[model samples]
Target: MMRIAIVGAGIVGLAAAHALLDKGHQVTLVDPGNNQQRPTDGNAGWIAHMDVMPLASPKAWRNLPRWMMDPLGPLTIRPAYLPALTPWLLRFVLASSPARIKSSIAALRAINAEALPSWKALLTTLSLNGHLREKGILSVWRDRNHFLRAEDIITRQKNFGIPLEVLQPEDLKQIEPALHSVEAAVLYPEGCHVSDPALLAADLLRLALERGAVLVSAKALAVEPANDAVHIRTDGAVKDVTADRVLISSGVWSRALAKQLGDNIPLDTERGYNATYAKGAFGLNRPVMFEGEGFVASNLDTGDRVGGAVEFAGTQAPPNHERTSAMITRLKRFLPHLDENQPAKRWMGFRPSIPDSLPVIGQADKDKRIVYAFGHGHYGLTQAAITSRLITEMMEGKPGSLDLTPFSAQRF
Candidate 1:
């Protein structure tokens, strides 16, 4: 048995801890404990196994200027940060090539192919199955032109073996009567979502604790090699910890720590915001993604959550609450019957993003005692279980079921 220290206590870190414990390892998880800063608490919560397309695409590049001009659009890069962000931006643009997109889709599909089964197994083992809902998700388009443009994407998804069902206006109304002004929709029957993301995370943490894993509420400072073990420094009373292995899964903050281990990874934060309404504010059976608007509205346990946006603002910038308000405005336009007077809660969090829209999940150093597992971007929730399983396999020196080269930290 080995002693492992995992930096980060969000879903990814907690999931990794659970996997290590299942393998008979002693785990200590460290986090800053700032609930507001954690994306797991406020994400859209969709388990989108069928959505394997990378965000950086030729279409997105063509619309970049328009999106940049419209500050309230789905994607924006803060002008002040553009100078320092040039390198990452160039990489992002380069990743938009057709070949790169095809490669990314194949790699992402490999990971997503195992996502549902892995999540189901983990939930069953942890006895937290009640937190998930398998009603599937709907992607709706309001404009006929926009709907027509999605044919290529639908074709590609079909080629990749993703099950899809096209829905006309009447069909869409029958599936979600509350939705208004939808021109068309597509349903991915295999999709699922968490009813309450925060509660689900709490349940995972509880299960980890029950399995003899330790949770340390502190900020991780740095990690270094110490003799045959890995040394970790944190802000808690037990400031230093020595472990047989170390896993860096600290989300957006992972880049700096990986750099400390001699790997300079190009990672940035995709700032996302959300708005939640009262539970009874709207009636919806499943999560719906507004195609052109680039946001998602899902019925959660607490209420209906309207979330989606890709802002290039750095992690430290103050959130622009107007983004959440704009999403609510768009949601109201989509569902005219929604009560505008209902109190809404707003939140913003950072998603660790890479130029290729793929995660970095591999060894950080030559010794292989330290591992890197971050840069999951918007699909973090969907890919967390598969990532954990792969990490466990790597730590045990076993060949993982899927190829890890595509997601290797050395790829950068």
Candidate 2:
């Protein structure tokens, strides 16, 4: 058996650890802990298998100017970070071309096609089937024009063989009574979501631990490759951990570590903000994406999670709870009964994003012993299981079914 070390204990890292452990690898998960509001803890846990489209689309670029006008809109970029973000923004614009969008969709769909089944298999193995909810997701629209414009995209989704249902105003109530009357809604019947993201992360880690996987509760400082082993230096009392292989899955923090291994990946952070209220407060049978608003609300076991803005602020930016407030303010338009006075738990996390919307998931350099698997962005939860399977196959020297070209670290 090989000793494998994973640098990030978020959803992706933990999932990888579990997969490797099931394959009889001696796994060690290296993370500083979730005190900094890990993305796994705060995400609107949608297993978005049908969401093959990338955010960097021609339509999104066209709406950029108007979205930027509203500071608290679904997409925001801090003024001070603009200069540093220019390079990434340029690539993002390039990725929005029709050709690039089509390619991104195909690559995303390739992985997402197995997302649900992989999650099911993993969850079944872990005996945590109840954690995943397949109630599906509703993409609701308030504006009549916006709803009408959704037809083209819906047509495209149908062509992809995705199970989708268009719900008119009258049909909305039967699907979700909590939501107020809307112009229209499209439901992805195969879409899934977690009952509680944080709990899922915890359970996955706990199960990994139970299966003889070690949890190194320290921040990885550096990774050095020696003759036969990769050494990981960390901040914990145990200064270093040596392993036969190392998988860099540290989310947004992975860029620096991958660079150490001679791979300068163009990974950036998509700072996401969210607000959570007491359980049963915002009643919803399934997660609902408020189309055009750049936010989604879901009823989780922990509470009702709201807010999902794509903020371009760097990793060090302070948490902006105001974005959550704005989302709540606008949400009242749909859920008029929403009590704004209810206390909310605010959170912010970084989603490691690539300009092309594809994750960097392959060998860092010539050494196949070290693999890179991060930059999943919003689909991290949805793609984690499939990523784990692919990376396991990679580390085991087996030829994986999916093409690694699109997810290569050097693609940038």
Q: TM-scores of all models? A: 0.97, 0.98
Q: Candidate 1's C-alpha lDDT?
A: 0.87
Evaluate candidate 1 by giving its C-alpha RMSD to the native, one decimal: 1.2
Model 1 Cα lDDT, one tens digit per residue, 4-46: 9999888898889988999999999988786696788999998
Model 1 spans > 4 angstroms off: none
Q: How many residue pairs clash per model?
A: 0, 0
Error of 1 at 28 (Å): 0.8
Inter-residue clash pairs, candidate 1: none
**Sequence-dependent TM-score of model 1:** 0.97
- Model 2 residue runs over 4 Å out of place are none
lDDT of 1 at 87: 93
